[model samples]
Target: MDISLVAGLLALGAAVGFAAGMLGIGGGMLLVPFMTMLFTAKHFPQEHIVHMAIATSLATIMFTSISSVRAHHARRAVLWRVVKLLAPGILIGSWVGPWIGAQLNSSTLALAFAVFVAFSGTQMLLDKKPAAARELPPAPGMFAAGGVIGVLAGLVGAGGGFVSVPFMTWCNVKIHNAVATSAALGFPIALAGTLSNIYFGMKVPDLPASSLGFIYLPALLVISLASVSTAPLGARTAHSLPVKTLKKVFALLLYSLASYMLYKAFG
Candidate 1:
C-alpha cells in the first residue's frame, strides 16, 4: 500500500472513530462512501466495491465499538440489561443480512445504502422525542426490534446505531443512555456482520489483492488502529457536548455522502 494511502486511511479512521463515539453510529455510515471512493481510486473490481467497502467498514467497527463502549461503560451510561436482551436476536439477524445483501448487484446495494442513510440522517436531524407515555417494550419486543436493527445494519455495513439510537430514544430512553447502549450493541452487530460477509464473499472471484473475503484487509488494519485511539475521546466528548446540535451537523454530512453514493450507483 502507498504511504499516502495509509496516511489518508488513518485520517479517515480518526474522523470516523470520533463520529462513532459521539453518535454511537460505529462509523460505518461515514466509512462506507469513503471506502468506496478509496477502492475505486485503487482500481478495485468495480462490481465488488460496495460489498468490499461494507465488509471492511463492519470489520473496523469491531475495534471502534470496543474502545468507545469502554468509555461509555466507565461513565455508567450503558444499559447492560438492554444490551443483553437485544443481543441474541441481533446476532441472528446480522448473520443473515449479509447473505441477503450478497444477492444484490452493486448498483442496487449502492442505491439501498443511499436511501437508508438519507432516512437515518433525516431522523437524527429532526431530533423528535417520542410521546411521554412510550417506554421500552418487553423482552420479546426488544428481541424483535434488535432483529430489525441488526438486519438493516448488516445491509448497510453499520453498527446498528443509526436505527438503535432512534429506537431506544423513541422508547423513552434518555438520549445519553441510548447512545451509550448503542455503542455496546455495535460489538455484536460488527462481529456477526463481519463473519457473515467473509463467509458469503469467499465464493466471489477476482477480488483485489490483500483482501480477506469481501474485506480489504489493509484498510481494515489501518483504519481500526486509528479509530480505536480516537473513540474514547469521542465518547468523553459526547458526555459533555451538545449532541443534538452535533447530530444535526452530522446529518448534513450524511446527506452529502448519500448523494455521492447515489451518483456512484447510477453515474
Candidate 2:
C-alpha cells in the first residue's frame, strides 16, 4: 500500500475510534461516509463505493464492538438475558438485511442509510428520559425488536446501538445498562453483516486487489486495531459524562452526517 494511503487509514481509524469511545455508538455511521468519500476520491468505480464502504466498516466494527463489550461486561452492565432473547432474530435478520441491500442501486442504498440515520438521530435528540419499564421485556418483544434492529444494522453496517439502546431503554432497561448491552450486541451485527457482504459481493468483478468480496483487508486491519485501542478510553469517559447531554451532541453530529450522506446520494 502507498504510504499516503496507510497514513490516511490510520487517521481515519483514530477518528472513528474516538467517536466510538465517546458516544457508545458503533463507528459505522462515521466510518461509512468517510470511506465512501475516500473511495470516490481514489476514482474507484462509482457502483462499488458504497459496497466497499459498508463492508469495510462492518469488518472493522467487529473489533470495535469486542473492545467496547469487554469494557461494559467488566462493569456487569450487559444484560445477557436480553442478548439471549434477541440473538436468534438478530442472527437471521443481519444475514438477510445485507443481501437485500446488495440488490439495490448504490444511490438507493445510500439514501436508505441516510434516512435511517436521520430518524435515529432525531429519536435520540427527542428522548428525554428512560422509558417507564425498568426490566427486560418478555422474550417475544425482545425478539421482535432484535429482528428490526439487526436488519437496520446490517443495511447500514452499524453496531445496532443506535436502535438497540433506545429500544432497550424503552423496555425499561436502565440507560447505562442499555448502552452497555447494546454494545455487546454489536458482535452479532458485525458477524452477520460481514458474512452477507462477502456472499453478496462474490460475483462482482474488478474489485481492488486487497478486497475479500466487499471488504478491503488492509483498511479493515488498520481501522480495527486503532478503534479497539481507543474503545476502552471511550467507555471510561462514558461513565463520567452526563449521558443525556452527550446523547444530544452525538445526535446533532449524526444529523449533520446524515444530511451530507443524503446530498451525496442525490447529487
Winning candidate number (TM-score): 1
TM-score of each: 0.97, 0.95
lDDT of 1 at 153: 89
Tens-place lDDT per residue, model 1, 1-267, is 999889889999999999899889899988999999888998888999999999999999999999999999999999999999999989999998888889999999999989988887898788887899999899999999999988988998999888898788878898788889999999999999999999999999999888888999999999999999999999998888776766676578678878999999999
Off by over 4 Å in 2: 128-136
lDDT of each: 0.91, 0.82
lDDT of 2 by residue, 1-267 (tens): 777777888888887776766665678888889888888888888998888898899888888988887887888878888888988788888888888888888899899889998988887888756545466667887788789988998988887877887677666666678777877788888899999999888878988888998898888998887888888887777767786876786689789889878988999
- Candidate 2, residue 209: CA error in Å? 1.4
> Where does candidate 1 have its weakest 10-residue lDDT segment?
241-250
> Under the 3 Å rule for N, CA and C atoms, how many clashes does model 2 have?
2
Q: Quick one: best lDDT, which candidate?
A: 1
Error of 2 at 4 (Å): 2.3
lDDT of 1 at 183: 93
Q: What residue runs in model 1 are displaced by over 4 Å at the alpha carbon?
A: none
